[model samples]
Target: MDLTVLSYVIYLFISIVLTVWVARTLSRAGRVFLAQVFPGSEHLAEAVNHLLVVGFYLVNLGFVSLYLKSGATTETARQVFEGLSVKEGVVLLVLGGMHLGNVFVLNKLRSNSRRDFAVIPPIPPTGFLPEVEA
Candidate 1:
């Protein structure tokens, strides 16, 4: 196999693996945050975590599979170094960036959930008032 093909394959593999790993980690940590977000329903929070991971994988993998590889060619050290084309690089960068962004957004959501549900003061119960005789 050619080096370029190998490189592309490695890149794709690593990108997918990284994305999935991050997604799973976020989902696991998200349970706590999700609890905060939804407050009263642990089941709902767990479901949301699962759904987020599923959606994240579906979107990211679809994009990665559809990504176009750069043209293959031979070149000297300088050419090879300078040969990093804008299109391919941009696509890979975007892929990585999207994964990173997903993690960031999910983390923020989790934190917000936690903050939104921290704690509350207890409510006081009122006894019945005495009725006046007519």
Candidate 2:
């Protein structure tokens, strides 16, 4: 196979592998975050974690497939390495970006949930009333 074809093959393999690894890592940790976000709802956390993993796979794999096109010919070993580096680097950035976005959104949900449950009386009782015989 020519160097260009070789680079495509290598890029696809690395991109797919990296995406899978990141998805798994996020799924594992996301459960905990989701649990905190939806406190006292283990099932909800697990379900949300599963949905997030599915969405992550779809978005990232779609990006990889769309980005598989080579920008220039990879006729030499150096070209193959360079092409792979750039392609892999972009994939990594996309993965990191997705992770951060998920975290930001979940944190918002967490904070909102906490606010809903928080209870702070506007003012303390001026005085306690004397107990009367029932």
User: Over all chains combined, what TM-score does candidate 2 have?
Assistant: 0.86
Poorest 10 consecutive residues of model 1 by lDDT?
Answer: 78-87
- The digit string of per-residue lDDT tens for model 1 on 73-113 reads 63444433344344346555765676677667767887876
TM-score of each: 0.58, 0.86
Local distance difference test, each candidate: 0.67, 0.90
Query: Alpha-carbon error at 102 in model 1, in Å?
Result: 4.6
Best by TM-score: 2
Q: Name the lDDT value of residue 94 in candidate 1.
A: 67
The Cα error of candidate 1 at residue 78, in Å, is 8.9
Model 2: per-residue Cα lDDT over 18-126, one tens digit each: 9999999998888777888888889988999899999999999999999999869888899899888999999999999999988887788788888888988799789
User: Candidate 1 clashing pairs?
Assistant: none
**Candidate 2, residue 54: CA error in Å?**
0.9
